[model samples]
Target chain A: MKTQHEVEQFLYRQAELLDSKQWQAWIDLFTDDGVYWMPPEPSHRTWEGMPAIFAEDKNLMRVRMGRVLHPDAWSQRPLWGTNHVVSNVVIVKSSTNEVQVRSRFHMMELRRDDVRHYAGAYTHRLKKTRGGYRIKLQRVDMTNAQAAYDYVLQVWV
Target chain B: MLQERIPDFSKFVEPDRVRKEVYTDAGVFEREMERIHETLWIYCGHESQVPKAGDYYAVQLGRQPMLMVRGPEGKVHVLYNRCPHRGNMMCGDRHGNTGEFFRCSYHAWTFHHDGRLRNIPMMESGYQGTRYGRDNPECSMKRAARVESYRGFVFASLAKDGPTLKEFLGASLVAFDDMCDRAPEGEVEIVPNCFRIIQHSNWKIFLENQLDALHPSVTHQSTGRAAHEVEKMIEKKTGKAPLSYHMLSAFATVTIDKWDNFQTINHPQGHCILTGYMGLRPKDPDTLKYEKTLIKAYGQKRMEEILGVNIHHVLIYPGLSVQSPLQQLRAVRPLGVDRTLTEIWHFRLKGAPEAIYRRSLAYYNLVNSPATVVNADDLENFWKCHQGLSSDGGDWVSFARHFGRDIEKDGVVESGPGMGTSEAPMRNQMKAWARYMGNGK
Candidate 1:
């Protein structure tokens, strides 16, 4: 069993990759069949039958990365940046090859002249492999999921 | 507050160009609420949303806070959200069951689901000599001047008199018809919640973009190209790619000039329809099953006729934009001159296969979700447009593309041959806006 400190280290490294705009490296933290879901509400348990903010597999994530990194993507022209503070790490359950971890995150995103704060609870089902932990599923429950946002959320929360 | 001089709308709104004030001025937005959104028949909500008795969905039509609630006897009523006494709002939450009757959180005044007064606390002692009583209409929650539902989709008009809901919808009624008819059960129900986005742009900018047919290639090129690249790579490796990838890639594959092949019928009522270009009828197993279900419901010939209704989008004048083919619609509620609230709602076809619903869900998430790059770029442009319009760099916003080339027949304007990118829709909308503004006091 991996220690709680070791799991925290893995999460911090993942957050570092995302903050540096290393999308591919951040995506590599996920297992091959991993899913990232951002449902509109916390009550939305599944993405199959209802609407979701994002419910992308690795393939779609790669596609999204491609768009965000593209030169002509106007929304990225001014190039937003995010600083993620991941704390309150708790290992809820663990098994030989898998563990479920929960954490609270506050991401302050800067785009153009505005700074938006997104705080959320992240529940990650991590798959333990020879190398390290890989995310099987990451569910983001945004605190302001129902807010009438000023504009589109271009990047992942 | 009254303006010293009423600005002439005729000068601001011309045939092919409208003054920037039309979009940037708060005064114009106020006039729009009075003359356009409040006066016209605005879409309230589908009957399916408030299916159970006492179930209420709060909706904002123009500036009025209203409620669309299902009464005990299965009638859906659109009433003012305010209480008749003391002007307190009846329902505070977005939507919920008010139980047997609506009991005001303040002062414990109760009313039936139909907005009729049931009883007021200490009615005999408190209101014995007052005009407030069950016999007086003022004692009850005020109802909208007109409420009508067509094929399960309800709409309400605040003004006492005007064109009926059917007349207002006109050719645009096909939006609902196309959506409901596609289902084997001939109905579509609203999926529980919606994505509410507040854009920092005028409401008209969003409406104009609905049938513009010219911005997809320019604005979404980067996102589309990226999806196309991934789709091709997947196709090369697996010999096939999912249809969801095609939904994004189509923006890149369908070049700018090819958009000219699709036509827009710009109605005088400001309603517009863009000819279908997505070619949604793929012969996959899921689609085939859905087709079989539809055939069993309606005869094969009728099913084909229903499926072959060439429509990509329908812009319902000043407030609603419907993509019936995909079973989604966006209701535009202008919050202010530069702030607009849009409710994006998707529906499930009653008798279609679950996989078919998934297809529409894919489009809803990929193309319309706030996180999607397609919508992100569009929103960026909308914000930029509003910012620029508020500046003094330009006075008029041009709608001059193919200006004189549109053919008008019996008040319906159609783009000239091979002129699908014409600005006829924007022109038609502004013409209607001018008429509505001119008619108002």
Candidate 2:
């Protein structure tokens, strides 16, 4: 079982990997079938039979990474770096090999004079693996989910 | 002299043309929020958005905060996002059920889904014989001047009087009809959550560009060209290019001159329709199954006719662009002369198969979502256009393309046959804008 400190450290590590442009490392944190989700609704969401607001298996995540890290991704030029501060961490529930954790994240990105701050919370459904732990699911719903956005969303919350 | 309500209206508007300041001036923008957006039957949302009792979706009416909520009786209501007592805004969250009714956080004033005052704390003592009693209309949350729903979409006008929603919509009603009629079940569910974009340019810029029929082949050329090359290479190696590539490649392969091939029909009150370009009725299994389901829902002949309705897009004047072929509609709310809020929403055709829904999702993500590269390119141009227009680079932005070339008959305007690159739409929209900003209602 992972302790609060251990989980916090892990979350920080994930942010560092993303901030450092360790694309492969960040990509490897998920289980083979892990799903990444971003609920588009600012309020209640019952998509009925539809899959999800955004449900991407490993393959879809890979496609996203390819587009983001691709040299031709002019949107990523100068490379925006983000600092993710995760707080209010809590272990909603824990089991033998799985844990559900909820935490708030405030991400600030800087590309020279341009800076954008994305404040949101995340719920991670994880499973204990032989090595450590693998993300089973990551669900993000931001405070500004309904706000009009600028450019492409090439970064993770 | 004209009524004092609209002073200087003559200088800002004309029958044939108007000053650019109408779009670039702050005062004019503010006046529009009052006289147009708030006074007209602006769209609220779709019925599917709030399917269950207590479900609600928040939206903007000009600069005011408003929401669309479904009551226990299954009726949709549009309400101001404010509390009646202390004036604290209700439903701080973008959307959610207020349970049976909305209870204000400041003073615990509760309101029903119909926006009727339900309870006020210590009602017996706090009110007594005061005008602040629960019976007072002021005690309850206020609704727009007029609220009505067409088919499933909701619209509200702040002015208590004017044309009815249907009357105002007129030919623009086709935006919703074309969308829901295409669905076999005769309804559509908004794909929950919209990609809202704040364009640095004026709201009019985005609206005009929607069916401009001239920018896609030029502004999106580079990205489209890149996608087209890959599509060709993939087609060479394999026998087919992924549908996603064609999604992007369409921008590149469809030349500016070829744009003239599509036809645009301009209706009264600024509504316009662009005839079909994308062939959605592929004889694939998913589409076939969806068609079969539609046939079951409606007769085969009706189903065939619905599916055969060749419409790629419908611009529902001043604020909306509906892509019926893809089951998506975008709403525009102007923030200022230079800032605009746009919500990009996709929909699920009721009774469609999972694969069919997924196809719409693919289009949503590939072309409509904020993550779309196509959007990235378009946003850049919008920003640049705003920058250019604000500068002294030029006083008049030309809507002269294909001018004096529109073929008008029976009160509708169409461009010369063969090319969609006609500026008839620009002229049509401007005509409406001028009328709205002029002396006439």
iRMSD, per candidate, in listed order? 1.1, 4.5
Off by over 4 Å in 1: B1-4, B439-441
Best by lDDT: 1
B33-93, model 1: which lDDT tens digit per residue?
Answer: 9888898999999999999999999999999999999998999999999988889999999
Task: Supply the DockQ value of model 1.
Answer: 0.80
Give a tens-digit lDDT track for model 2, residues B54-170: 888888898789988998888888889888888899888877767877888887888998888999889999788888886689988888778899888899887888999899888
- List TM-score per model, in order: 0.98, 0.81
lDDT for B216 (candidate 1): 93
Consecutive 10-residue window with the lowest summed lDDT within model 1 chain B: B1-10
Clashing residue pairs, backbone N/CA/C < 3 A, model 1: none
Q: Which ten residues in a row have the lowest lDDT in candidate 1 chain A?
A: A148-157
Which candidate gets the maximum DockQ versus the true structure? 1
lDDT of model 2 at residue B363? 74
